[model samples]
Target: MTTAYYVHVTIDQGKNVMLLDSGCTQSAFPLKEFQKLLFQFGTQKISHQFIIADIDNAILLRLDFFENHHCLLDFQNAQLKIRDSAVRCCDSQGNLLKVNVQVRQDTVLPPRTERFSMARLSTKWVQGTACIEPADTVPGVLVATTVQDPDKQQVHLRLMNYTDREIRIPAGKIVAMCLAANLTRPAPTESASHGQLPEHLKTLVEESCQGFSPEEKPKVQALITEHQNAFSSSQYDFSKTNVIKHGIPLVPGAKPLKQRPYRHGTAQEAEIEKQGQSLIREGHGA
Candidate 1:
């Protein structure tokens, strides 16, 4: 039989110890343990209801685990922050705008910094939404969009202020939380070049692309659409394109150097060259 080695990670918030299984396909925590820690340290929303289910189509009953929660754990000089709050947008004054955030079930929370990464706590994908609630207390709702980074490992949230007055968001208080909404299985994605479509067009593409073949036709069409959206080249149309095409204009003091004959250098020159070679070998040459 093969030997199994496991690493234990401690979560200081609830004094919970989690097992890190390298051989396992996905990370997970016991339901009882999850509930215990969540109750002790996590914030729950009594107004919101969340339903968690299992792969066998059985509803894994859970207590109210809706409101945003943050539990920070430090490991090896890296911070592993756990929370349901995926999007946190603030202004220069540290004020967050109350806005509705809709994201895919597989959306991972954005990292705090380059050094930080999301801890593999569970394999289960959870979908959620912080629905648009009446914000009469605040001036107005801020419009926001969630953007994923080029690497696809990171995501960014950009919020635009719409109201005249500034809204002050208090520390540790969530203006809106990313709530669990739905669970989805992995499926073939659209054209790789065009990742996620704009919200308005996304719906249209989804509805229309359903009938189109995912392999060949859609990919070609998406390529065509992207090329069509590109900016038109002005050089071909501008009359001044050929006016300065041949050669660049020279500055007043700029003169081309004439080739100099190679000559034997003096002792000082040889010493300087030796020092230069030493510097280059030392990896400090410019």
Candidate 2:
């Protein structure tokens, strides 16, 4: 938001207001008002000329005695003080049309003045697109078995770090979770109603499976098993390479939750957690 104030000026015996906006980069007068004033004053003659920002223009009339003449302008309530200033008129193609003498006002005031403290005007222009969805139902992560439609079945995974450290989850890890969840076939001993991964994702899962190291195969397999049981289970936890863990559920609409009080189970646990948290705050450890 930005604001600018202009003083009164008379054209053709009628009052018109002029606002100087440097952002415009050109002098402009209201075309309709200018025409009306010209008709009323019946003056095509030029009175004075001056330069404004290196452009020359003519000032045919001055309206300094606005109050005495009973002429009203757009910013009638504007308090004005006169100083030396000038303006120039230009055409659409940037050609210099004419110059006009303008009176400048010292808008700056002393620090203690009440007018300086109290006088203010503001204007705001909102400038953005709205993409916000209902807070209650936004998904934090997508799972392979989770249906894509908002009205259908969806899995909301909550993640947290209660260990007094910052954790980074690599993109590869998330991709692996998706692939593993899609690849696992139902055991013969399990029920037949459990859904299988779509055929389109089989090739992707196979390719991703080949990229896992020997040590990672067990973890991937475990994640698949846990995901299958996640709906019925109370909670799940998994560690990441960056010392952070995932699979914790975020409370719905819980962003405004306040910080929990520090719990000290024992003196030793309290000291260790305190020191660890301080180090994490200092960026020394995850």
Candidate 3:
């Protein structure tokens, strides 16, 4: 079954009417309506702003005072009201320009239910002469689970991490991960041939590698190796060194190398050559 409702809107000034579907977020009427209303009522503008709320009971938008306008909405016998002061408008455009509108609804939500499931195991033994009877199944550990009730119309979320690790994901990081997973097209197979990293990861790596030195490449490599070994051995503890607190740096000299023009030679060797040339040019050494 479809889950939506329609709202009928009317502008009392021009006697104009409109039908708004459930999906409609905003609505507006022609300017002439406000001009006619103001002329007839002899009022500069209508007071009381209006708010539009969705079926889920979320405020969508608010319309301020209506200038050169009369009543903004006639809810077709619905019990909606505008509690705020009226919107204002300048004298320009004959005060009849189209005025934007929003729909507000008042409703209550129902309660949700929870459910649970289990996994089981069984065991049996056999002797050389006779087979032993099967043992009764034993119950495993119990886990809590919650899901949105189909009958309930609301946003719900459930998170389960078996390891019991405390992972605090930053809002920006979560957004980046979501975008990365939803790329429209597959990345090129020969990305390395182009000598460029993916835009997003490249940005992350660049930001991470900034201010690193050629001499520090070994240190960065060691850090990465340490993390890899610790993780592989199941000895890594995020609570001890969180990414936000102890960030991972990129390959050594990556930042400075990126800032300078691409050199055909090895990056590490090129950096050394550039430094040597600068020193020689400055009459410091050969």
Among all candidates shown, the one with the greatest lDDT: 1
> Which residue pairs come into collision in candidate 1?
127-180, 127-181, 128-179, 128-180, 128-181
lDDT of 3 by residue, 1-286 (tens): 2212122222355522222232443333333222222211233333332333233422212232222222354332221223342222211112211111111122111222222212111111111111111111112111222222211111122222222233332221110000001113335335433443444343344455668897775465444433332232222222232212334658976754347675666888888988888766756667
Q: Global lDDT for candidate 3?
A: 0.29
Candidate closer to the true structure by lDDT (higher is better), 2 or 3: 2
Query: How close is every model to the real structure, measured as TM-score?
Result: 0.20, 0.16, 0.16
Q: Write the per-residue lDDT of candidate 1 for residues 140-201, one digit (tens) a residue.
A: 43323222211221123332334445544332222232222223334523532455443334
Measured over all alpha carbons after superposition, the RMSD of each candidate to the real structure, in angstroms, is 25.4, 24.6, 24.3
- Residue 103 lDDT in candidate 1: 25
Q: Model 1 segments beyond 4 Å from truth? A: 1-138, 145-155, 179-286
Give the TM-score (vs. native) of candidate 2.
Answer: 0.16
What lDDT does the true structure give each of the candidates?
0.32, 0.32, 0.29
Model 3 weakest 10-residue run by lDDT: 173-182
